[model samples]
Every structure is written in structure tokens, then in C-alpha cells.
Target chain A: MSKAAIIPTQLSIRVPVLNWAVWPHDASVPEGPAHGFELQYIDAMTRRRLSNLTRMALHVAGVCVGKTPRVRTVFASRHGELHRTVDMLTSLAHAEPLSPTAFGLSVHNASAGIFSIARRDRSSATALAAGEDTFGYALLEAHVQLRSDPAAPVLVVYADEPLPQVYAARSCAGDRPHALAVLLSHEAVRDLTLTANRSTEAPSGGMQSLAFLPWLAQGESGSWTGHRHTWRWH
Target chain B: MSELKLQIKQLIVDALNLEDLRPEDIGDDQALFDDGLGLDSIDALELGVALRKKYLLKLDAGDASVRAAFRCVNTLAELVHARRTDSERTANE
Candidate 1:
């Protein structure tokens, strides 16, 4: 058996094949101000619609519900309910009295809670938010969880939108609404060889030393086809 | 009374961002929950805030009578009218 064939057939599949819902610069809500990417510019891009956190949960339920399988979910949103949060905070600061609707929608983990409600999925699921490092940390957490339960697959969905103007001043990455959902399992018939080391250079310093997860999630795979740090085949 | 109900319906549509919903869509006595407009708990809270700001009506969430006042668009408008009239009488007194 080849080395790839000889590897233990753990249930956690590595880099298990997945699909994406890409959102272009221009979409349905064109006149809704420059929230993120300018829709008119990225007309050529294919932005998936079943892509929002709410919709993603619906899709996950569609995939995992009623199946003879055990799967857990991890949802990552760098700016979870950010637009709603900012609007509520702005109103509160202005002494405008908080909107109960806004307060409920502004919860960071509302997406996760909604997912649970939709699927009635009482299984273990985690919601994570960690700024720019969100994707990396989420992936790491999913990896560790999969290692613990080799039989079940871990579904990792990363979702983020551009921060509002006030928040952008503090930390903004020009990222539009982008999301990637991957099913990770130890049953690695084929998977990426991931490795890393400490470096004096900044994390996003360059291609070789760069963190590819964010770029990859944003559909920059062409630029990182043969890069180092993280390796993915197929 | 009908005019007041219409205005209240319009306010509810706008305040709740019920896109494209017209005043007629909201029946004066229709239930605002799973049976009628499919509103949820959050919408109730938002409606309360909008009522307070737009009508200048003071409402405490802790008040028991609020449940009856918020029963429907007609009830809310009536409550507002009664409250305003009471305030006027007290001011005269």
C-alpha cells in the first residue's frame, strides 16, 4: 500500500471535499450602501446565496438531518451580527433606548442558536469569534475535536462580513461577505499536509509565510496553489 | 377610530421594516403571531419601542395593563388615545 493508503483509516476525513457559496461585490441589496464589497465591481464573481449564517444553518441541517451518522458543527463568524450590533450600540450611545428586536438579533451566538432551533440538533456545536485569526483558530478547534471522535465528521463553517465604518477604524480587512463550509474527518483518503513554525515575520507577511486560510476562504486558491505552511491536495 | 387604526398599522409596518407590507395587510383585530402576521417575541419589543417614541406614550414593561394595550393595532391606538386624554385632564386639574 502506498504511504497515503497505509495511513490509518481514521473516521475524521482530512480536507474532506466541500462546496462554497461565493458572494460578489454586487448582489441583490445594491442600493443598501457600501456595506462591504462594491457589487458593481465584482459582477463576474459567483456569490452563493444559501451563504448567510442563517442560510448556512439551514443547509447544514439539510445535509446532516435524518442521516444515519453522527456529526457536530462549528460556526465561525469574525463579525457575527456585526451590522446589527453596531446599529444597536449606536442607538444606545445616543440614549435612543435599545430596540428589543435589535438586542435579540445582536447576540454573537444567535446564529448557532438558530441553527439549533432549525435542526433541533441537541448535539455539541460551538460558535467562535476571534478577529482576523478566526479562521485559523476555528480550523484548529475543529481538527482537535475530530481527533477525539474519529468516527464522526466535524462541519466547520466560517462566515464574516465587512465591519461597519466605526469598527473598521479599529480592525478591518476589506473582506466582503465570504463563507466557506468544510467537512473534516480523520478518514483521510486524501488530505492536506498542514505544518507551521514560529517566524519573526508577520503572519500575513508574504505568500510563503502568509496565512492561507483567510485568503483561501475568500477564493484566492489560484494565488496559493503551491504555497507552504498549509498544503491541500484535491 | 378607523383612521387611527390605519395610522397605527402604517407605523407598525415602517417601524418593523415589514418591507412592502401595506396598512391593509394588517387587519385591526388580527393576531400578530403565528396565526396572522407571523410576528415573534422580538417584534413585540420593537413595536413597543416604536409606539413609545412615535406616540410619546410612556409604557413600562412591568405594567400588567400593557398586555391588553398591546393586544392589537386597534387596542394600542385606543390605549394611546385614552392615555393622552387622561394626561390632558390631569393637566387641567
Candidate 2:
């Protein structure tokens, strides 16, 4: 008898909450001379270490207290640590030598490191830096990892900082760096179904490309284009 | 020195993005690491970077003296003053 290929089923998410920190209609970078998102607005958002998105994680983590502390965490950022990287490079150019602090924080995964340390979570944490398609890619990773162990929940966090002047010149799409994180787990009530299909190009308009909160807030669903990737939610 | 100390305190607040802190809140000699400001290793690193950028001073890994300089904002300003004079001496020589 021929062996049949196993097609994994996606686990359902219960009590899913999406949080965002968006800076719209305000200039995050004023004469910053770079394309990357500036850290100027970080303080504007909140004064806490976790920021807005991580605060959401804290709540989501609470919902799954005992179930958490072991679930894998996936973080996606399109332009991770751009400001710190810019500062480090400029210091190096002058032979000033990068500060150990700046260099450490400049890593793409630094936020995840902070999140892990704060939570005292020793679970697996994955940091991804895929420009444009970061959101869709993160969701896909979460779905795949969720299928690996149906019993465990997966926390997926997506964050972006605004472009600094140098990076802005090259890849400034909009005026905000928004973040959203979802805790995916198996629940009896299935809230949503996600399927993937082939697409030749990204859609240019719609709410799908925006953060999940806005989509939920506006009561809109469907395909949307963000950066270089297309996302569809029905 | 006191004036310089005040400036350094403000710098610390700004660099760390300490929203609720005020210049009067931080005592000059209190430990900036754990008890006082609740700063961690990352804060120390960021402070070092900010200090170097503002004062144009390079930290030497071999020297225990560097720790004394980073002990507090006052100490940092004193170190900057001394370095400035030392550089002047070298140029004159």
C-alpha cells in the first residue's frame, strides 16, 4: 500500500487580540536625514519597556498563563533596529567605535530578547526580518508552528519602527511603524480560517495590508497589499 | 561642576527616555544601576554610547578607572573636563 501524505490542519485561536502603535499625520522624523523610522516617536507612544505591543503580549500571556511560558514566540519586523544601526554605522565611520550598548540593541532580534527576559520565558523565540511581506510571513510561520504541536499556543508579534532619513530616502512607504501580535492556540470555537493560494503580485489597495486591529475596527476583511506582500482575510 | 552635573542629569533622563523622572529625583551619588534608577546592563551600554557621542571620549576596556568615570553623571562630566584639558596639553606639547 502506498503511504498517504499528511496534510496538517490549522489550530484555532481563542480570545485573539491585536494591538498596534501607529503614528499617522505626524512627522516621526523631522530633518533626520535618513529613511529609517526614527526613535523620536518611541517616547510618544509610551514610557514602558514593553511598549504598546508587548503590553498586549502581557495580556495575551495572561489569558494563557499556565499554557504560556512554553509556547514559541515569533517576532517580525520589516525594519528592525534601523535607528540603532544608523547610529552605530555613523560612529564607526568616524572611528568613534560603536558602543557595546548600541551594538547590542542594534541587532534585529533585540526586542525579542527583551521580551523573553521580561517574561522569564525560556520557550523558543524566532525573530524575522523580511521587508514588506513581514506580516504575512509571520502569520504563515505561526500557522506552521501551531500545527507542529496542536496542544501548545504560539504568540506572534510584528513591530516596525519608522525609517531614519537614510532608510527613508530608499524605502519610506507610510508615516507609521505599527505592530500587532496574536496568540494562536487550539480552541473549540473556530473564529477564522486561513488558506494560502498563489499570487503573481501584491494588491495596491485595501485594509488587508494594514494592521489587524484597524481591519477589525473598521469591520472590513479581504485582500490588501502591504510593502511587497499581499494579504487576504475573509 | 554642579552646573555640569545638572546638565548630565538631564541628558541621562533624555537618553533613557525616563518619562516620570525629573532632575531633582536623582541624587548625585546614588547608584544609577540597580537601586536608584533601576538601570540594567542595557542602560549602561546605552549611556556609554551617549556619553561617548556627547563628550567625544573613548572608553578603555583595560582600565578600572573607566568604571569610576561612569559611576554617575557628575563623574562623567568631570572625566570629560579632564580629558579636554589632557587633549589640550598634548596639542600644546
True-contact fraction per candidate equals 0.47, 0.41
B1-93 in candidate 1: lDDT tens per residue?
A: 787688789988877777557889998888776677776666778888877766667788888888677778878878877664444435655
Q: Lowest summed lDDT over 10 consecutive residues: which window, candidate 1 chain B?
A: B84-93
Each candidate: how many clashes? 13, 17
Root-mean-square deviation of each candidate, in angstroms?
9.3, 7.3
lDDT of 1 at A171: 51
DockQ of each: 0.35, 0.39
Candidate 1 TM-score, true structure as reference: 0.69
lDDT for each residue of candidate 2 in A115-142, tens digit (9 for 90 to 100): 5665567878888866666666777787
| Candidate with the greatest lDDT versus the true structure | 2
True contacts kept of 1: 0.47
Interface RMSD (C-alpha) of each candidate? Answer: 6.0, 3.2
Docking class of 2: acceptable
TM-scores of chain A in all candidate models: 0.63, 0.67
lDDT of 2 by residue, B3-35 (tens): 767877887887777778897787788778767
Residue B79 C-alpha lDDT in model 2: 78
